[model samples]
Target: MLISLSRVIKGYLLSALLGVVIGSLIGMSRTINELLLPMITVIRQIPMIAWIPLIILWCGIGEESKVVIIVLAAFFPILVNAESGIAQTPESFLEVARLYKLGWWKTFSKVYLPHAIPQILVGLKLGLGVSWMAVVASELIAATSGIGYRMSNARSLMRPDIVIVCMLVIGIVGILMDKAIGIIFELFTPWVEKKRRD
Candidate 1:
């Protein structure tokens, strides 16, 4: 039950990218934080499956619903990580940037993002795992196609082996996806590697 690598990569990238965008907005804006804090808290408290009924009602078991579900699962982690990472950037670094007469853009690109790389990746990793699981949850509840739906069909057919195989497929794919992201992060963020080594 191997899925195409291209499709898997596309799904992972799309979910992570969308999650980062929303997370960044949420992390940066006091107004949004105030508005969404309660909503996010509530959503976080509920299991991903709890939303399936409502999602189905609104999106009709389509791709939109599944994407929304994954987004919901993914967005919070990336946002929280990025915000915390940015916040954690040393005040000393800010001062150094200012002393250098660096513009806001330069300061962010140089002093902020590099320092935040580890934390940002942490969030991305967490969000990706959650999104993968959320995809299965969404498929199990609503979608006609997906590994989760496949498992469900197997159960209906009383084929325990098929269910086990599908579960293995999801697990292996999820692990490989996370590993790929980790490798990419390491490749792109040598500063993080140096810090860890030190």
Candidate 2:
């Protein structure tokens, strides 16, 4: 369980960071977005589990394969949401930044980032969920240790109680991770909460 949780956390964080950066760049560049969108759409249409066989062949039935699967599963929703968030930045905000003669970095940090926070958080939440699912699936197929592996072993022995226990652990851990992200989101975007109240 701990091993699986670690994989999910690490994969989720890295994928979220990469997705946001790449998505922001693409969102800010119409030509790049247009060039990449079709390919991205095609890749996203492929189910995460479907990649398992190829990932195993490429990475072996090891921790690396599980992590790779988790990362891939977590990446796409984040990329899509981050791109949409940046693209949806208000024109008024851009106009104000231009009027202030803000540099690109300043404009992005002050205007674009704040405007995109909610959507980014939404993406992160979705990514985290997918990461959990991916890690479990990967573990069931390939791992030597993890909640999924334990459950699989229990199934062979017909130990339904152990399987149930593993399921509960996964569920609890997932809820904790999600709540932790929610707390961080609220902490970073207090102004959004305040505005909502007003």
Stretches of candidate 2 off by over 4 Å are none
lDDT of 1 by residue, 1-198 (tens): 333233344555676676565555555456877887678677778876787788889888877777777766776777778777876778899899989999867887898788888888999888877877777777777767778788889889999999988778777877887898889988988778888999
Tens-digit lDDT track for model 2 on 57-137? 999987788888988999999999999999999898899999999998898889988888888888999999899899989
lDDT against the true structure, each candidate: 0.75, 0.89
Model 2, residue 149: distance off in Å is: 0.6
lDDT score for residue 101 of model 1: 100
Q: Assess candidate 2 and give its lDDT.
A: 0.89
